[model samples]
Target: MLWRAISEELPGPKWAGLFAEYWPFYRKWWLKEGEPARPTYAECRRALKAHMPDLIPLYEDLCDQAGGGDLAARFLSFYCPPPYLSGCSQAVWGGKEPVMVRNYDYNTNAFDSLVLHTGWKGRRVMGTSDGLFGLVDGVNDAGLSISLTFGGRRVVGVGFGVPLILRYVLQTCETAEQAGEILARVPTHMSYNVTVLDRKRKYLTALMAPDRPAIITKAAVATNHQENVEWISHARFTATVERERYLLQRLRFHRDPEEKFINTFLKPPLYSHQFNAGFGTLYTAVYRPRKREMEHRWPGTVWHQKLDAFEEGSRNVLMPGIVA
Candidate 1:
């Protein structure tokens, strides 16, 4: 798989090029159930204005850059987009430095595999990009970092996608407390567990769902599911319960060093190689909110990015179990 680190201060030719490259696949997925199945552009715009008014200008900018098309505008809104799911495990390491480590497990074919560094609307944000503008996991200049995991449930409802919610949080909020407010306020189309860590070492996990009010917890680790395992089949398939138990034990019982703690995610129970099953560990990310730095790690290789001096580059990763 190919991964890229792109630096663009704003939405411009670089972003437009990305749109042109990924639009075909996105358009097909957006219309998978036919155009009538999705909401109208009006509803999408309304939701964006209601929940994330601060991002409207940026959204419009990206929409125009995407050829000013109606479908592109609606897609960029990230409001009530088609329901998608991924297997992930994230946690806040409350050791010496405030760090957030996570393994993003998802279909390699469906993933963006892009790390975008942007200073848009005066906020410097860097992280894995999703849906063109949305973020899967990222850190802002304000010393706040966030990541998400699928809440093991099958319910899908009316709300914005969680990636956009993460993007909105990093764009506007500076602390975990502020992020909790937005996470609780924003309605999510599907259930997800979003964990936020600030430079001050404060962290919280918000269990958000469309059908229920968001539940805020001071939990350090978040695997799939919320509170309890609601989706038995999914839980078993993703080993959510096992993974959660393993992480909880590590955090509560074992006093592991910083490097040891981060390294655990690259091994069993966390690192996964079931690519043929559509959910493999694409990459493990470690974020140091206080330092404003992040690392993308595979088995042995690592790519680093820092807010102070960001670099644009690319790497070709050989997927596990694939003969090169």
Candidate 2:
């Protein structure tokens, strides 16, 4: 259970090589014994091509470069699975550059692959995926930063996963309005809350789901559920209520500089180690899109990188585990 920092350019062999190395291990976790991941891949591929045609070529190139019969299937897993992540995200702008903080919470044993990918075609994305094709939380070179929180639910449908949709936004969008347009158009497999920050010091939180259309709001925090929708996963959704309150509390009343508010995510409520097993906070990310920079902080260390000149290297951070 560790996080790795990796970087590569697309249409290059190095990026494909990285994909080959982790695809096997990630495939094992994404498609367990007697799972329906294959069918999910089919739906995912179709949806990707239909909504985001730009991805089809990139995906095909990745598979061809990897030279694996199941490469596409492996790649699709990152974008087709059930929405099984929990976390907190908030965008703050108070007479300064916007700062977006996100803490990714997911199963430590379940595809625990975390990577901060830089020097990509258009954006620098960091996520718990095998490669740089998708994003869990990332900031683009165009000064648009985004983070996702699972909209607590169980209903799975035919739609693009939120991460891939985020990928789409980073690839083609540069403003909060454009990012919101993309988030609104793409249907998600389940539900997600995407918090976006732009260079213009504008911020927005979009609640997206397959059952309903995307909803935009001016709220600073993007948690698992919203005020209008009744979440399917009641128990998990119940927990989000407090986390949402905690994030909004910081945004509204905590009158401080950007770093101070961002640091709050590294503490309780926003950060947690799952005692019951499954998902937990992998790491906390703070992105300053205007600076074209991002900081990833774990327990004791922090890694900083810029979108234009990212340090190409890999460092491992120990993983979290459960106790009896």
Taking all chains together, each candidate's TM-score versus the true structure is: 0.99, 0.86
> Which residues of candidate 1, in runs, are more than 4 Å off?
322-324
* TM-score quality measure for candidate 1: 0.99
- Residue 233, model 2: lDDT of 59
Which 10 consecutive residues of model 2 have the lowest summed lDDT?
A: 123-132
Off by over 4 Å in 2: 33-37, 40-45, 68-83, 93-95, 111-113, 116-132, 228-238, 318-324
Q: Which lDDT value does model 1 have at 160?
A: 92
Error of 2 at 157 (Å): 1.1
- lDDT (Cα, tens digit) per residue for candidate 1, span 199-242: 99999999999999999999999999999899999899899989
In the range 1-324, model 2's lDDT, one tens digit per residue, is 455566665546766666667767756655664355545556656767778877676667666776745545555535556445555445555546777778777655554354555445544554435234677877777788888887776667667667778877877788999999888888787888888898888888888888878899877776667654466555353367777778777767777677677677777777777735555677778888888788878777788877777665666765444564
Q: How far is candidate 2 from the true structure (C-alpha RMSD, Å)?
A: 3.0
